[model samples]
Target chain A: MRLTTLQKFLWAAVAVALVAVGAVFLLVDRSPEPIAQAAFRPTFSLPDAGGRLRTPADFEGKHLLVFFGFTNCPDICPTTLAEVAQVMDDLGDQAGKVQPLFISIDPERDREMGLAEYTEAFHPSILGLAGDAAQTRAAADSFRIYYEREANLEALDVYAMSHSPGLYLISPEGDWLGQFTYGTPASEIVADLQARL
Target chain B: MKRIFATLALIAAAGPALACETVTVGPLEVSQAWSRASIGTARPGVVYLTIRNSGTADDALMSITTPAADMPMLHQTVMTDGVASMPHAMEVPVPAEGQVALEPGGYHAMLMELTQVLEEGETFPVTLTFRDAGKVTIPVTIQNIGASEPTCPSPDE
Candidate 1:
């Protein structure tokens, strides 16, 4: 015996739903993998913790992860470095091809040894760079970071400075790849970099 | 035996009970109200406050709410390649035992879109929304931006 019209309609609805779901998955498969925020590299000849000049030319053909911060930052600075350390680890052997750089915002306080000690705390692979205020400021401006000295004059060393919190990814050609925000998953970073590579 | 039992009961009744957090209006206890200042000439700003749980239960500070800005978010000021970025954060955990502190260079309730620049020693209403304690509206003191420590360092640098 033939089924009721209601029953036939239900079967047809099920067929349509299955096709729609399949087409969605097919479309999703065609899209590019989730790429990390593009990372930007700044030009600087500032000395590293060892007082050696590290310029853009040194990064000839390697992926670069750079962040601007000072030794005295208490929280976000440390946490973001820790996460970047994880990202380097996740890269495994390919990690050898990537360099993570820490630039000093407080160039006066973060001299050669100071920056070296700070970046080394996270990983031996991480390097700290520092330069005069004008140089650091240029790099910050290129990245669109907004930082200004706080208004109080009495506490010269205790003033507040606000800046962006992203680890920029730079290409071998030194073009800016997008950066990921703080606390990005290690797997996500590695996967994104791999696609870029 | 009756006298002994009565004495024992009295001792039990006299024992101190467990302490809970107490929420107070107006004045908030600040943690690490530092007298030290930054190395630059900019304003010396420190996030200060202590959380008191005056109840029998515990609560976590899920977020902070302030009308002073277009949006107030939890933020972590991180550094990379020498760049500092204060990224937005969703919540700051407040343990049952006490309140969490939002300190400088660590986690801070980032105030954005200020209706007016925060003036020193002025009080403004800031509401803290807790996971368990609901929302509490309190006045936050805008102290000297240039002061070095908790109270304020010397007027002279």
Candidate 2:
């Protein structure tokens, strides 16, 4: 017994509906899971340039733009700081809602070298943060930043530090939102922050 | 006499471009030499340039000397897995008939223990020693503290 045209059409429609449902399920299963907020949350208890202790709580309501470098880094650090300064400038009045921190990986020398003056040269809003060796290590670990002093046999006293060059973006609540790698233009950072803010 | 006068005029016209100058020594031509101004006297300065080799044999950059800093050494910023490390490079090779650029985030002359603070718009002489070319001094223009590229004087400026 041959089926009617309407019945055949109904069967075809049912098959298409089933396929569509399966496709949606497959796509949803294959999609990446959202990052765990707790795992990426970074914490630090370092001292600002004024020797006053600073923590994420201090900037409770402001977005944090964090960078790790030392005063002695000639190329990458300065270039990055300059970009940060540009970002701050572009932010204008909105910049007051953000706090930029330049965390020194080499606390011993950066302290003596005057981290405040170093950061101020870029932007007045930027606060240079430094701590003792152990504190520095803990802060770096929390940020997942890698740094090591390069030993030079020829000039033992003068050594350079090799570190992770990343500009991290932290939410006001202290969650690690994302990071802008080295070479990210200030315009891009400004746009990103504007959307978030 | 006309040809000599034209050559002199050309040199005079090219004077402004000297802000981004090229120096030739033996078979190597170094150009686009520049550095960023220092924040303070204590911070080290860095110099970046491009070296082109016209010779048939490869020549290595052996040493760098600059009055801007007491200890000028060749250093390369190496990045692996998003981690950055600047190691002292004993020599950077300029391949035969090839060019090597000492740009930012790459090979640079690390000026350790700056003798003087580098000021913007200033120029400093740095002597580069090559294995086959001996020595040649090039003027490195000082750009802004965070300048990513060599500052070229605009025609209007």
Candidate 3:
């Protein structure tokens, strides 16, 4: 049947509306939903103090508490690590479910021996991890940790490193929980972990 | 007069027994001197204390010397964007009628190239030279590796 020009225009308009509705539905179904911030996870494969490669899969079924610092840090690092030790003490038997990892950003100075001594001084269960320059950078980048070595003055052999201080909490299922800022009380950390666990 | 003399003797004895070791030189009073136990001789260690000046004039901490260490330098830990860096400080100022605290995350004395290891529970001597108060020697108690402050004896005792 021959259609009038107006009738043809109306049919074309109807077809265009149907196509628009179909495109909207396809777009909505194909696009991925936004993920919650807590569920974000960045993986890292780094070396432990014994020069053994460790990955996230190795820590499955346990919550991981990760911190970034150096051994020679006389003040902040030791203070924070002591707080973690206190948290462990506060956790009592439940401490077995939590794994505390100390990641060294200063690979040049902090080696197996130094890391071992430092971590052992704080707690026997706390594991010390360090990687080569490339691996260290990759891990820091993935964890969004900031670190920089200050200028060596007076030609002294010893130098200082500045880094972001915090405790990164990873869930048992390998998801990012949150970060506790510097000087977070041990009681608060223990309570948070208990609630989450 | 006899009672006053007896009271004075008791005060003197009590002063020395206080847990907070303090040395008064001229108008400067230094107290709570402490350092962490070192693992080895070559490793650097830190010393912390509080200095108060009661005199009418300001004083400056010129230098620190300890026989246990080869060289002692004044240093401060500065934190920027979560990074902590220790920079050598020429001198720390102590205002008159004010106090200055050398804490863990702040100013401290960096003992380099120790001649002997500082063992826990042991004490060492550190000589602080002030611009106006001259030099005062104080015993610094060696604390555990992670101790933030020196253990103070309770006042009740």
iRMSD value for model 3: 21.2
Which segments of candidate 1 are over 4 A away from where they belong? A1-41, A153-156, B1-157
Stretches of candidate 2 above 4 Å error? A1-39, A152-155, B1-18, B153-157
Judged by DockQ cut-offs, the docking class of candidate 2 is incorrect
Chain B, per-candidate TM-score: 0.57, 0.85, 0.83
Please give each candidate's TM-score: 0.49, 0.80, 0.79
Q: Largest TM-score belongs to which candidate?
A: 2
Candidate 1 at B120: error in angstroms?
37
Worst 10 residues of 2 chain B by lDDT: B1-10
Ranking of models by lDDT = 2, 3, 1
Candidate closest to the true structure, highest lDDT: 2
Cα lDDT for residue B133, candidate 2: 89
The TM-score of the first chain in every model comes to 0.73, 0.79, 0.78
- Fnat for each predicted structure, in order: 0.21, 0.59, 0.38
Model-by-model lDDT, in order? 0.55, 0.79, 0.75
Q: How far off is residue B136 in model 2, in Å?
A: 1.2
Can you give the DockQ of every candidate in the order shown? 0.09, 0.22, 0.15
